[model samples]
Target chain A: MAKVPVQFTLNGSEKAEFIDSGTTLLHALRDKIGDTSPKGGCHQGTCGACSVIVDGELRLSCLTLAETCNGATITTTSGLAEGGVLHPLQRAFLDTFATQCGFCTPGMIMAAKVLLDHTPNPSREDVVEALSGNICRCTGYEPIIQAVLTAARGNSQNAA
Target chain B: MAIRRGRGVAAINYPTGMNLGGDPTQALVHSTPTGNFMVTLSSVDLGQGMKQIMAQICAETIGVPTDCVVVDTADTDTGPHCMGTFASRGTHRAGNAVIQAAKEARQVMLEVAAEELEVNASDLETDGQGNILVKGAPQKSISIFDVALSAHFKRGRSISGRGMFLIPRSYPEKETGAMKPSTCYAHACTVAEVEVDDETGEVTVLTVKNVFEIGRALNPKMVEQQLVGGSWMGISHALYETTEPYYPNRDHGGTDFNQYLMPGPGDLAETEIIVLERPSADGPYGAKGPGEMCANPQIPAVANAVFDAVGVRVDTLPITPERILRALKAQAN
Candidate 1:
């Protein structure tokens, strides 16, 4: 397989990289770009742990190929925080005790963040639908729902 | 507090004896000769909030804030040996260790205070605020920290504490003919009302009401979260979640995140957690382990609820829609 040069914007910075033909976007971001926030749970699109926002749409980075993400702008879990402060969703998780093992946190947060980005005040149903792909063995969905609601309240407060 | 069954006991000694002690927070911190706080805890957190509960036990015993006392998990080299974190042993075992440690520290501090106040060690009283007060002399007082530092500086001896709480070794009560082998059991009864689709066999759990005897609840909010979260996992295991085989080959039929499903928002209805405050004689602050205990009963409770709803009993776990349909068909036939 021939290694191809790829250029893309990652976490608000433009990066040029070259990767083998079979390399996935997840590998490009994790190994080559030194960003490991988007975990490789199931290389298949079944697990949503590899979910990331590309051009305002949530997509599973594991399913996305390096070639397809050329010149694209990508935002991962590492990008969620700004200036050493956690995102509202992260804080909400801590306050609500949403995270246990912390393995599924990045993906679950990204999914919930994407849902809330579109629907600021999402109902429990909406939150479930958005996060249906992410699997967490520790917390049953109650705390996750509570964390989402807390983030929604924060979003409204910020808006006000 | 034995849980008596019909003319017999489920376990020989289901409900163990309860410990009674006055608010002895001052003696743990004020006394000297700090002992090793030994504990047995399972590595897994079943959501019972044992970590915080252990902290509370140490804090209350040693006259310190909850924030100051750090709860440790079961690692061989940490301090003392502990059982892995299961069966709700965190507070009782670890809390007792902390109590012992604090007691040792208190004894030494009291001795130093006795010398400073020119009074007999037995006559001096350790106040709740970690101060040693001379009887009938309100003006004569010394702080626990000062006494400890002074003992270390003047006597050139280290002021420390240690504690160890072993699970009571006992045989099943012979006359009772029961399996009561648990160190201390926390009892709980949960009622779940669920709705079933007669045609599709899909079950929507409407309400779950649980009343559990958890020796004591150190942090109510943390407890509630554990209950709610544990219940959710239990519900999923009962109705939705399953672990299929993992295959390296893509062609092989395997269970991954997509095929192996669990519960989401639409699957649940209302979840209610009721914590019973029956102080265990063995536990620190009287709290039982609540995390994994609730999880074991979820599948059976939901299955029972399904039976209540549509009159079908599921023998296997994860009473899926297909299994429900088959059972309903068999029942109809």
Candidate 2:
């Protein structure tokens, strides 16, 4: 396969890479940058597990060709945490047992973060609308919804 | 000498927003032969956290940290083959086993303590730390480890325990000729309200409520989480999934998560879980199976919700708007 040069900012860092047309942004993020937080669930963009924010809009990385990134900043789930401590959303998820298999967590959290960033104090309906793209097989949305609400309430986290 | 056997039972709870239709029953027992205690289960975790619930049951029954009680998974190699793990039978069945095993271990400890301390078995009490205390004297004590060590070294004996349980069967009112003691039932009711686009037939689940009657809750948080996830799976099955038909002409196709349309976050209604606790006679800590029971109602609930919104009842699953629109057009003609 022929190769193409691509440049994109990952998690607020500058990066330049060369990849073939068939190489997806997900592949570059996972294989090249070695960030495994954004999972590859449905490479066809149906399963939103590979969703990422491109220039502040939620986009499916699997569907986007690597060459199209070209100097765009890509933020993944790894960037959600600070210095080994979990993000508030991650902590809330654990406390409320929102995450079960954890396969959809990174994307779910990313999508939720985008919503929260835009609407800091979103209503329950807003949270639902924001997370509609992610999928979790365990912890029905009840616990997850509660966790997001709890995080918004300033509850202490890191409890097992 | 604590062989308490009781009839298993089931109860139902319907949430304000949702209606449910299913039955699940579970039982558990704990026993001790010598002093070695083991926790066993017929429930499969499937990464759903059943193992943790089993450990918690042991810890609560025997009074130890959940981590202290080791879990043994489904093994036909072990004695007493269970019905297998699909119906949330772990805490109910395995929990009872842990209780029986822990009680047996406790008996051995009491006997040894009574002999060494020159006190009657009735006069001894187990401290929360699995230690034996001589009632009035707080300082004169022995840990479970000490008792286990004594039984192994000084007494030249070993302690062991076992447990067994089974759920009562349901559907057919009374078991007549071929009835084996299948006496456990867990009930749930789920409701969903939805909005469907008349043009595209894209049905959006607006809200969902699940109300269940579990005999007991080992961990309420975990139970609620699993139920929610399960509801989503059911909703996915009802509205978005397509299965390849075995018949020559039908359209049955797809492989794995890629081709299949499982319910993403977008497909789910804002879910609410209402847990109703009504302890069963046979379950451990009054705990019953609640895992698979919730999934059953979610499908029908979504289907009904779509009907409420668009006045079109979807008999078949994966009720896409395309199908709904087609149904509407067919009705118009």
Candidate 3:
């Protein structure tokens, strides 16, 4: 297969890589760029472990082709920290003990980030609906939901 | 058809560790030159907080701060022997080994402090804040760091300890086949409420309330995490999960996550948990294994709840809607 050239902004930096026609964005980010925070729980989109933000929209990296995201901006869990400071969602997850095995943590954080970006203060049921796609076998969806709500409250408090 | 609501309860007594062939685990504790401790083991954590709990055990046994201990596990070449992590034996078996090892290392640590303070080893006590002091003497104290430095450079002593824990296997008698199979038993009970549709044969779990009596909770937060997550798995196993949906004839089997169904986040039930501490004689700090038993009682409780809701007994792995419908049809006939 002929390698296709792709360029995209990752974590606020420009990155260029060559990938095959059907190579997934997950493969490009992990294998090419060496950012391995997004876990591959399932190659299929059902698990939601490879979730990422593509141009401010939540997209499953496993299902999105790398070539299609040539000029788009992407954000992952690796980019959530800035200058030794963790994001509010990351801080909430840690304080709330929302992770167990942590295989699904990055995806869960990304999904929560998208939800909070859209809805600054989400109800409990809204959090559930937003995170319905992700599968966490360890936490039973309780602490993760709590973490998102906690982050939302913190964000509102900071805004206030 | 209307939805019928009913509740059911189940209680279970679970044995800690496997009794077959003498289940064993080992630990090695040693102090660094900086007074920090390292616990080496071949057991794996599997994200159950094994490393954290082991560090806590080592810290408590050695009378040191928890942050001073680092648990390095699953290194076959350098770490000690372990019988793997199963049978809910990690905490009960491996924890005891870590305690014994830490005790021996603590003995040497206190001895070093005793020599530094010009006091008998018996008269020395650890303050659990990185200091060893003469008993009842406020001023006669030395930091663990200085003691460790003295042991390494001045006295030329290597502070290390090794420990192993094994439950002696008992053979069954020839006549009655009776034998003591476990060192300790953990108990749990669960009450499950369900709403079943009489016509559609659909079952929805409303709530699951449970009480677990482990020997002791070394880490209460981790214990709660396990119980909550395990109950969710129990509810899934009761109604949702199955690789072989049509068993006995393996023509159709699930090959992926989609086919192998599990309860989604929306399918969760309201879970309430109450934990009781009844310390065991042989447990580490009276702590029993709560790994596998947290998921057991909910299985039976959900099954009994299904029976209560629709008045049908489905004794299958997963009480599927098709099975419930079949049982209802059989009852109608």
Clashes of each: 38, 48, 0
Q: Summarize candidate 2's per-residue lDDT along A31-77 as a digit string, tens digits.
A: 98788988998787766788888888888889988888787878888
Q: lDDT of all predictions, in order shown? A: 0.68, 0.68, 0.92
lDDT of 3 by residue, A1-160 (tens): 8999999999999999988889999999999999998888889999889999999999999999999998999999999999999999999998888898899999999999999999999999899999999998888888899999999999899899
Which 10-residue window in model 1 chain B sums to the lowest lDDT? B3-12
- Highest lDDT among the candidates is held by which one? 3
**How would you encode candidate 3's per-residue C-alpha lDDT over B1-333 as one tens digit per residue?**
889998999999999999888888899999999999999999899888999999999999999999999999957777799998888899999999999999899999888888888989999888999998888995889999999999999998777788899998989999999999998999999999999998888889999999999989999999998999889998988998888888887867888788888887788899999999999999999999998999889989998999999899989979888999999999999
Residue B115, model 2: Cα distance from true site in angstroms: 4.6
lDDT of 3 at A135: 91
What stretches of model 3 exceed 4 Å from their correct place? none
Against the hidden reference, what TM-scores do the models get?
A: 0.77, 0.70, 0.98
Chain A of candidate 1 gets a TM-score of 0.95
Candidate rank order under TM-score: 3, 1, 2
Under the 3 Å rule for N, CA and C atoms, how many clashes does model 1 have? 38
lDDT (10s digit) by residue, model 2, range B54-129 = 7776666655456556666666455355555554655666566667766665576678767777788788887666
How big is the positional error of residue B85 in model 3, measured in Å on the Cα after superposition? 1.6
- Could you give candidate 1's per-residue lDDT for residues B135-198 as a string of tens digits? 7886888776677667766765444466655554445578885643555676666677777787
Top-down DockQ ranking:
3, 1, 2
What's the distance in Å from true for residue B182, model 2?
A: 3.4
Q: Please give the DockQ score of every candidate, comma-separated.
A: 0.40, 0.40, 0.76
